[model samples]
Target: MKDFELDGWDDEEASTDAATSLTRTAARVEEERQALTEQALAERITAAVNAARPGVDKIPDPVDPAGTGNLTADEQERLDACVAGIELLSTATWVAGKSLDTVATGRLFRKLVHKLEPERCYTTIEEWAEIEHGISRSRCSQLRDGWQIGEVLNARGYKAPEGQVRELVPFFNRHGLKAAVGVYEMVVQAIGADKVTAKRLRETVKLFPGDLALSDEDDVNVIAQSLAGAIEGATPPAPKPSTALPTELKREVDRRSVALADRLDRGRIPRNEVLTHLLAAFADERDSRVFDVVFERMKTSNS
Candidate 1:
């Protein structure tokens, strides 16, 4: 009887060990399967991103030693002529980034970035933006989108007025291109494009139930200007000599600079023009009673 009991205990122990071993083996198999699945998914994503961009690999770098930006002789000549034309248009526009001229420049700039990729001159969009615009990659992205949207809007018989193109990007992208264009034309007709303000459009979009959401907050001044057509009619002041301001005044200028940029159309405005306007306003108003009280406080602080 003792021998039989010992045999039963040993069999039970062997069965338990076998079960544990099988569990570990199954876990290992599952892990291997998961790793392979992830690898395949990553490859698919990379291929899709590459496939979405056509002609990326085909364009040669402008600096390629093969000449004409790495093109054959005839191709080189063609690209050269194209490049020259782009430059001429850009120059003629006086570097007006938000204007129609920018559409051509942005298109050519995108093509150039792709062409230069083979040479590894600019490995990423950020690097390209830095070298091309001397601005942040994010800002470059804004300009590129604005340019493309402006071009499309033009084709659809809608002129992208001032900063409206940039403001309407997410709107256009959220809705299909055709639908967005139609919507823009409808909105323009309803409010009159010339009377349309970035702020008004933003508020209008908020009322939209589906397919369009509010993309950004509208600036108060931009809203007022758009409604009044003030910015459209306001001529840029003549260039003036630079003036150094006190530290406190400089801070105020800096604060206002940001506000002014936000307040204008296209989400960007020239710093010089902004400064000129600010300085002129201050100069003209320095003798006003409102400034006298502010100046008295400054004098007291100094004392």
Candidate 2:
């Protein structure tokens, strides 16, 4: 009887060991599988990020014999250093513009301007940029404004192309960061992110009242939906002689018309008083005619 009991105990022990071994093997396989999956996911994310990055031209080596004529050892070294410094600055500026890294670009501009000032190489960043780097004064201003706009957008977890961000600078300056960010977010939500262009942003921004105050709690989607509805319902006005107004003047009228309509909708201006105010304000015949044309178009759409 004792021998029979020992044989049964041994059989049970062997079965348990086999089960434990199988569990260990299964756990090991699962861990390996999970590791590989995670690695693949990381690789895919890296690839996507790389694909989205803008291409930059490779900087050539200044010291390469193929690119430089024969020179003394010291001359070659000095020339190499000078060329490298210029290339570094130029490359950094180009990358900043492409990557929308405006803050870095602005800082680099300041440093270069200061360095050149004492050496009498250039008196101002604008001069240095134009003469040395071939960047225009307008372009320099755009980059500087981009830095300010970028700060606001980055704080709000948004990214835009430098051109798009530059377009927002005027609105940002007038309405403040919160309002600018709200408009940006609304535009992005309305149009797919990839489809946003400077022209599109400019047009959308013109729809908002310059004085309209937006708070953090404001639902940007509400604005976006309203604008979308207005746009969808709007019909192209029949071209009139007044439509020949200068492009700038026409844009101003469009902005005013939109603002007036928004005010009317929000009850900021009494319905009864709208016409009185509008007529009194439009003393100039040309201004009145343009406003009349634009306002009528706006009224038709809203109605």
Best by TM-score: 2
List, residue by residue over 280-303, the lDDT tens digit for candidate 2.
666666557856777899999999
Q: For candidate 2, list the clashing residue pairs, or say none.
A: none
Report the error of model 2 at residue 73, Å.
48
The root-mean-square deviation over C-alpha atoms between each candidate and the true structure, in angstroms, is 23.1, 22.2
What Cα-based lDDT does every candidate model obtain?
A: 0.57, 0.63
Q: What local lDDT does model 2 show for residue 5?
A: 48
In model 2, which regions exceed 4 Å deviation? 1-122, 151-159, 215-303
Cα deviation at 250, candidate 1, in Å, is: 33
Per-residue CA lDDT of model 1 for 128-236, tens digit only, reads: 5566657576665666555545555565555455356556677667754444444455467668777766776665544444423222244423333343343234454
| Model 1, TM vs. native | 0.31
